[model samples]
Target: MIFSRERPFLLVGAGKMGGAMLSGWMAQGIDAAAIVVQDPAPSPEMAALLSRHGIRHVTEVPQGLTAGVVLLAIKPQLMDVVLPGLKPAVGDETLVLSVAAGTPVARFEAAFGPVPIVRAMPNTPAMVGRGITALFPTTRVSAAQRDTVDRLLSAIGTVEWLDSEAQIDLVTAVSGSGPAYVFLLAECLAEAGRKAGLPADLAARLAEATVSGAGELMHRSSEPPATLRRNVTSPNGTTAAALTVLMAEDGLQPLMDAAVAAAARRARELAG
Candidate 1:
């Protein structure tokens, strides 16, 4: 379902995630002429992409240009300030898809007067076209519109449709913020390696490469992550020795559980 140009796609923000999504869309064969990017100051990379593709770019919502899809990819904190300027561009048939975390569909309905809205949470991995997005559409969104949104979001990566909006917060806590968690793991691994007498640069490279390689392997394999983990562990092996500590009653599991809970709590708080 390549987005057609009945009404142009009015992108609200063209920062990293948005830019990456646009890049993916272009790669997936969406017509660049059917897109309008509204960003006051796109990053250099994004700017270059826009220029290269001849995609329309505006500092603010353009007057008289109708939008088929108003994809809001800005930060949640900026929603209020950005919402008012967007109303004029949205049409009755437009689908409002938001990738901003903690922003509920009600918030958009309040501003747009009962439009079809979707609240989604996509991680930074979208920048590499490997991200997964969780989408929850309002009742106003029809099945056809949902399919359109799915195709659009699929440009970034896989799309998961949620049964309830409440689950968005949990998804946000996990995959939405999961990249940072993985990065921290890499950082910690590097530091531990350095402490164990490896050179800093070599340790950092080893940790990063290992994490990315393992992730790639997992991506290509049909095996479950737990199965892969078990395959890596052997009787009295070095990996098993480390797993013993990590699997302890008060180890990574509890810490991760607490961390995810706190993130979900904060996401709920941010919704208000």
Candidate 2:
């Protein structure tokens, strides 16, 4: 499918992730009339917001409603039930993008019959337009279609394209499930602060701000993360003291390696 100002986009689900994409598109001044949202039970906030924007919302896929780009944002487990119903709305010319985890490109190809399929693994931060999405497209997808998907995802956050679908499983283990790891860090840091005698609220606030600020710095800085980390560490200082333990043979390195391995295993299992 060729994406142009004239092409209408269909978002098959309007949950948190889907809503975020719609909001990003609207915020970027994309035409509201060019988008169609389909959800059986869209949130009241979403319903009201879509209504205010004058965008189309349907509880069911309307007959003969052809969309140039169709976003499959529904749960992977529900793809079988959803795709069959959506087949009519999806034309041969439609470019299908699936954000559902573990549902491979072959599944969509089987259902949609060789329609250009781009599978993406987007993190939770996309809800705030600061996420990163890793995309993997089938060989059948045209360069134009790939560019269109890339642009659409880039609106929400950074987009990274992988040369192989095998990398998507690793992407799922990293960025797809990475947010929770960062949140866990915040949790641990907050607990440690409280143990060091800070008030619970202050500890939580400090932890949140520190993590967020560090992440923003890493994003804006030209230096690699290791450089930023080394810059903060001073010989015999508190930061170094902490690093001594964290960088130990059985510390964060081994722990993270094990964690990512487990996550990758789970992703593979889910795909199977």
TM-score of each: 0.97, 0.95
Off by over 4 Å in 1: 1-6
- Give the per-residue lDDT of model 1 (tens digit) for 1-272: 42356578889899888888899988888888899999999999999999999998999887787788899989899988999999998777888889888888889988998788888898888878899999998898988889888887788888999999999999999999999999999999999999999999999999999999999999999999999999999989999999999999998999999999999999999999
What stretches of model 2 exceed 4 Å from their correct place? 1-7
**Highest-lDDT candidate:** 1
In candidate 2, residue 265 scores what lDDT? Answer: 90
Instruction: Tell how far residue 53 is off in model 2, in angstroms.
Output: 1.2
Tens-place lDDT per residue, model 2, 224-255, is 99999999999899999999999999999898
Q: Return the lDDT, model 2, position 252.
A: 94
TM-score of 2: 0.95
